[model samples]
Target: MNLCMIGTGYVGLVSGVCFSDLGNQVVCVDKDKDKINLLNKGRVPIYEPGLDEMLKRNFKFGRISFSTDINKAIESSDIIFICVGTPTSKKNNSADLTHVYRVANDIKKNIKKFKIIVTKSTVPVTTGDKIEKIIAKKVNKKKFEIVSNPEFLREGEAIRDFIYPDRIVIGTQNKKVNRVLKNLYEPLVNKGAKYLNTSRRAAELIKYASNAFLATKITYINEISNLCEKIGVNVEDISIGMGLDKRIGTRFLRAGPAYGGSCFPKDTKAIAIIADQYKSNLSIIKSTIKSNENRRNLFKKRTFQIMKNKIKNKTITFLGVTFKANTDDMRESMCLKMIPVFLKKGAKLRYYDPSGKKKEINKKVKFCKNIQEACLKTDLIIIHTEWNEFKSLDFKNLVKKNNFKIYDMRNIYSSAKMKQKKINYFSVGR
Candidate 1:
């Protein structure tokens, strides 16, 4: 399969690399010449564990290439994947398809041969129809088949997810397209990945619905952690008890800060707006959004309580600042919202993430090169994200501060252990 991934963002880069690794020739096309150049120079722009090695291996083998020229990549490939961004619109909260449409228009211009145009990006329902219409204006329907194949790749675990997806969804009723896509994914299908073929709209909705439900699960657990905090219970035990059920598997059940990755917050809001557009009320999802928003403020209050309401001149350090561990993405991270508040209250702040310093953070705060630098002399240590580097730390020796407090928002540490160490430790639920 000769594949061209339009937009060499997280989705496109990972998918193109993996497809190339699977013996398919791939070209990752991005408008950003800098990112393309970085990839071509054997440097990855994004941080995903083991991605650089895989991309380099595929590139060295002459199986994969990165390009800024979309027209050349499109002309060279049989399958063109639109792996662009469809972020939530600030105006209506629906998915902003400006990038997707622009790519469609670009594809329309360079379809000299028959092509399989797959929407690998997360798009709203009927987006495939709009993309088809856009391309149809320039080329006949016979020249292209617009299929919706929304990516299920998580940011940190993209490589594993692509290779071992639970399901490969192809959204098209065209039997020829279906057979070709099935054959394209036959390697994974043989690896026990279920192949599901549905209508284009269903595939689009499936992506949003899956993200919304996962967001709800995270919100549900966080709310449970709040109740557990009031009643002296461990949210871990609650998570375990609920997860024992075969119906509700134990994923995204950990109590933590508000769900703030690239997908959850944005997709949940977009889907709620989508439901409203069809004259339907998604009360539960709406409540989840509201509750997640409140959770951030609650996290700030908890931090203040840990500091005994005296934040002035206090030195605080964040162990990790990204939304989750192993990814450099900081979009909608709780720390982004909390950092300014802490600075305004006269707290000197520093943060260290394994993925390195974040530009999203306020300039007033410091970026530590290492965990020890971030923790040294800090009055309070907040384990914001459960990065592996922060999991088993000698905080007593590291902080070197008497009576310093530790707030385990992700509950990465055992409260009993912290108690035995004679250190003041706070956790999500218990």
Candidate 2:
């Protein structure tokens, strides 16, 4: 299959590379010249595990290519996937569909023959109907079929998720469109991946629903963690006990500062907005959003309380800054919220992340060369992201050198071990 993927962000780039690896010729289009240039130079613009290698291999094999010409990409492909970003609009917290609509207009202008236009970007329910109307204004109705096929790729594990998705949802009423999409994903279907066909609106809602539910789970656990702290109960034990039940399998049960990333924060807000627009109330989702926000703010209060409210001259080091480990995405990161609070209290801040952007971070904060340097002489260490490197740190050596306090925000360390070493340790809900 020959495919054109628009908007080479995380979803577009990973999907293009993986689709090409699956024996399809894929051309990824992006308006950003720098990103296109970087890809042309055999370099990735983002940090995702195993993505660079797969991209290089597919590019080398002539199965994939990068382009800035959207028209050319559309002209050469039988299927076009709109994998653009639908960020939360600042105006009303609804999804900003300017990019998606603009792409639809572009497709209306460039699409010449029968084409399967797939909405691989996470979009609002009934967005496919809007796209169809937009395209129908300029082109014949027979020229295209708008299929809502939202992606479910996680950040750090996108490649694996793309190659081996648990299930694939194709939203279209057209029989031909459904068959075409099924064929496009036939490789995965042969490998035990479930291919579900549903209405376009259901498919769009599936993406939002899945993300909102996961966000609720994270917030639920964080709330439980807070209660555990007050009652002197271990949240980990509660998580394990609950997860043992077949009905409640554990995934995002770990207590952390908050849930922050591309999907949860925006999708949850978007869903809530959508519910309000239809005169429906999603009270649980609204509470989840509020709970997550409160959890993020609580980190600052918890830090100050741990320091006995004397943070004016304290030096703190954050182990990781990215929302979660193995990806360099800082969008909606809890650290973004925590940094200002610490700085406002006159605390000196240092951080070490394997792939976080130094320039994008606050100028007041210092970026260290490594974990040791970041922790050296620091008053406290806050483990923000659960990176594997942070899990096996030499706690005894670190504490012996600086006698610094350890606040395990991700709860990656054992409290008993830190206690045995006489290290001052604090962790979430445990």
Candidate 3:
């Protein structure tokens, strides 16, 4: 299969590389000349595990290529994947579809032969229909089929998620389009990956619904953890007890500051806005958004309380600043919110992350060179993201230098062990 993937962002770049590795000739097109040049040199702009190596291998094998020519890409492929970004609109909190729409217009001008346009971006319900109408305005209806094929790749583990997806949802009413997509994903389909065919609207809604439900689950457990803390019950045991059940299998049950990522924060807000536009109410989702916001402040308050409200002149180090582990994405990260608060409170701050970009970090915060430097001479240590390096730190050495006050936001440490070292420890819900 020959595929044209537009917008070489996280989803586009990862999917194009993976699909090319599966023996499909993929042309990844982006308007950014600098990014295209970088990819052509066997370098990727983003930090995804194993992506740079895989991209190089596929490019070397002549199975994949990068280009700035959208017209040429669309002309050469039978299937075009719109993997553009639909970031949250700042004006109304709805999904900003400007990029998606712009791609549609580009396709309208360049599309010639019969093609199947798949929306690999997370979009609202009926977006496929809108794209179809936009294309039909210029091209004949018989020349194309709009398919909603939303991606469910997690940032840190995107390659694994793409290669071994639990299920692939193909949203199209056209039987021909369904069969074509099945053939395109035949490699995974043969590996026992379930390919579910549903209406386009359902597929679009499935992406948002799944994200919103997961965000709600995280918020639910965070709230439960708070109650457990007040009542002096260990939330870890509660999480384990609940996870052992068949119905409530534990996944997002581990509580923390809150759910903050590119997907959850933006998608939850987009869905709530979508519900309101439809004259419907998603009260639980609305509350989840509010609860997440409140949790950030609570995290700050908890840190102050741990320091006996004497944050001024305190030296603190944040172990990880990214939203979650395994990726360098800082969008909606708790550290983004908490860092300013700490600085305002007159606390000297140091931060370190294995994958976070130095350019994305705030100028006010001191970026540490390594774990030893970050942990040394700090009044307190806070673990934001559960990065693997932070899980097995030399706590004894850290405690010997610092005040021995540690806040494990991700619960990556054993409280019993911290206590054995005579360190004051604080963790979420435990």
Candidate 4:
């Protein structure tokens, strides 16, 4: 199947590469000339695991290509997936669909053959209807359908998530659309990919509902983590006990800094804004946003509270910066929030992430070449992302360094182990 992925951001780049790896001739389109040039040179802009190798293999086989010429790519493609970003708008918490709308109009103006306009980007309900109306008005032919096929891939584990998803949710009951989609994804399904077929509107709603629910779960545990701190209860134990019931699984249960990244924060607010527009009161989601905001501030305060006096002239090391690790996306990471707070309190920041430093750090924050440089002679060490290297650090040697104090926001170290190592350790809840 011939496919064109508009917008070579994280989603576009990863999906296009994976689809190409699955034997589809995929072209990734981006208006950014430099980014497209970078991709053509076999360099991936995003920091997804195993993506670089996949891009190289696909390019060698002539399965995937990069282009800034949307006209040519769209004209030759059978399926055009709009994977552009719908970042939060400034005026309201609603998703800014300017890019999506622009892409729709562009496709309408260019396409002459019958094609499927698939929305691989996470958009609110009724967006497909709006796109359908816009395309129908501009185009003379009627051999087109709008399919809401939201992606559920996470950042660090995107490749595995795409190849082996929990379930593929394709929204469209139209027989022609379904047949085309089936053929397009037949390669993956043959390799054990399961899909949930439903209506277009329902599929859109499912994407929002799934993300909002997961955001709520993170907020729920974060709020409880605060209460656990006061009552001297271990939030981890509480979560494990609560999650033991098969109904409540143990994912997104880890307490840490506020939920950030490309999806949860933006999608939650956008979904809530849509719910408000329809006059449907989504109080739980509203509260979830409040909780998340409070969580970030509380983390800042917790750090200050732990070392209010001692932090005046200390070198503090942050272990990870990217939200949840694996990707260098610092869009809404807590590190952005906490870094300023600590820096304002006269703490020198030296942080190390296996992937994110080269992308996120600026002149204000000193980026270290290695974890040793980041941890060397630091008064306090804080683990932010729970990267595998941070989780497996030598605690004994770290304690021997100058002024050893470990604050594990990601819960990479156990309370008992820290105590045994004689390191002044702090963490969320227990």
All candidates: TM-score:
0.99, 0.98, 0.98, 0.97
Off by over 4 Å in 1: none
Cα lDDT, all candidates: 0.92, 0.92, 0.92, 0.88
Q: Tens digit of lDDT per residue, candidate 1, span 185-240?
A: 99999999999999999999999899899999999999999999899998999999
Q: How accurate is candidate 2 locally (lDDT)?
A: 0.92
How much is the lDDT of residue 109 in candidate 4?
A: 82
- lDDT tens per residue, model 3, 222-277: 99999999999889999899999979989888989888888999999999999999
| Candidate 4, residue 224: how far the Cα is off, in Å | 1.8
Show where candidate 3 strays beyond 4 Å.
399-402
TM-score of candidate 3 to 2 decimals: 0.98
Query: In candidate 2, which residue ranges exceed 4 Å CA deviation?
Result: 399-402
lDDT for model 4 comes to: 0.88
> Which 10 successive residues of model 4 have the least lDDT summed?
395-404
Error of 4 at 166 (Å): 1.4
lDDT of 1 at 93: 81
